[model samples]
Target: MSAAGSSTESARRVAVITGASSGIGAAAAYALAQAGWDVVLGARRLERLQEVAEATGGRAIALDVTDQASVDNFASQIERADLLVNNAGGAKGLERFLDTDMEHWEWMYNTNVLGTVRMTKALLPKLRASGDGLIINIGSKAGLDPYENGSGYNAAKFGLKALTRVLRIEEIADGHPVRVTEIDPGRVATDFSLVRFDGDQKRADAVYADKLNLSAADIAEAIRWVASLPPHMNIDTMNIMPRDQA
Candidate 1:
């Protein structure tokens, strides 16, 4: 933890980000910190997470969003949070529906959908208390478009999209100032393909070998922009894609 992480600087809004070990989550933490927001990073990889925390002058806490106990413990450590970026999600396999693997489906649903639910439910109170809270969910283009051999990931992201929408409606209906936004990125070049292919470097390389892909920083910029908006303004959903991606 850095001095900023320990400071009683109540004026600097705190943003809690999950999956902050790398990629969009880590980038968002840096972007927000640079913009004067205190960041609290959470991820399963404590070492990598701490590196990001150190760079951002934020605190790092071990967190596995797919685990209920982990989410609870993470929530307990956060003293304040004006923004929550639910970014811990990814694809597992690329098998077709007929050859569906339940394990892949389970992992996808647990991490992408239920993980957000667990984190949101645990920290909703703190968010409500903030008076100007915002929840930004990192969804994917897979959720909005159906493609071959993407059953598990597509379904998981689609479920996340539904959750984002319903949560937004409920918050509004309940008269809470908490804002919800979903950022669906088309194709961001990250370790996402490597993990999905289970560390097959060749397979991962092919994902962006001959195509224009968005960088993690691109999505991170979007997250920062949404959080920087006025409390009264709610950007329900933002679909960010590379120019060549239709």
Candidate 2:
């Protein structure tokens, strides 16, 4: 490639997305790529991640967000990151606060809350250097409205909401160019239920069956839209829910 061509390619905005192996993450990767943003995908499942990368013409790197070493390695591979989508999180189980197992809570907190912290910490420098950086944290409506039998997941998402807000405030106070936004979705039809139910396909299917539910692609569109907006604009939080869902 000529120097100009290389420069143009380098100038194209690049986005990094976690949990890109499947669900909303994968859809977001495709949507961003379709919108002319170069995307880098990361997930623990390398094969699935590679498939999405291939389909979207993006790069895939194996990443386990819950692990600090993995997060470090993932960050080191990226040369530039104008957008970072922290989507690598899920619920383990649904139980009442009284019946909740500490193990589930630990997993939820580590993956949903600490995982975002690790990724944001690792990539903040690159984002700041980009001059126009954006970080989109995938949160859940459960964070705002707690429900029965969802203590662990609710707490984790609530924590994420708090973290996202604080990060935005800090960036403003520090006069950094980086922008922070949280996309809090109510219910998207994805493998989230399967993971939460521990591979119980029936239960997972039942969650969305005969009910109006959002799709991963729906959330991906929101992500793409948010990233495509002018740098001067910052959407602090967006809550997406199906029309039928109150």
Query: Please, what is the TM-score per model?
Result: 0.96, 0.96
Question: Whole-model Cα lDDT per candidate?
Answer: 0.92, 0.93
lDDT of 2 by residue, 1-246 (tens): 211112357578889999999999999999998888889999999999999999999999999999999999999999999999999999988888888899999999999999999999999999999888999999999999999999899999999999999999999999999999999998799999999999999999999999999999999999999987888889999999999987
Candidate 2 residues lying further than 4 Å off, grouped into runs, are 1-7
TM-score of 2: 0.96
Off by over 4 Å in 1: 1-8
Candidate 2 C-alpha error for residue 52, in Å: 0.2
Clashes of each: 0, 0
- Predicted candidate 1 versus true structure: per-residue lDDT over 197-216, tens digit per residue: 99999999999998999999
lDDT for model 1 comes to 0.92
Give candidate 2's error at residue 163 in angstroms: 0.6
Worst 10 residues of 1 by lDDT: 1-10
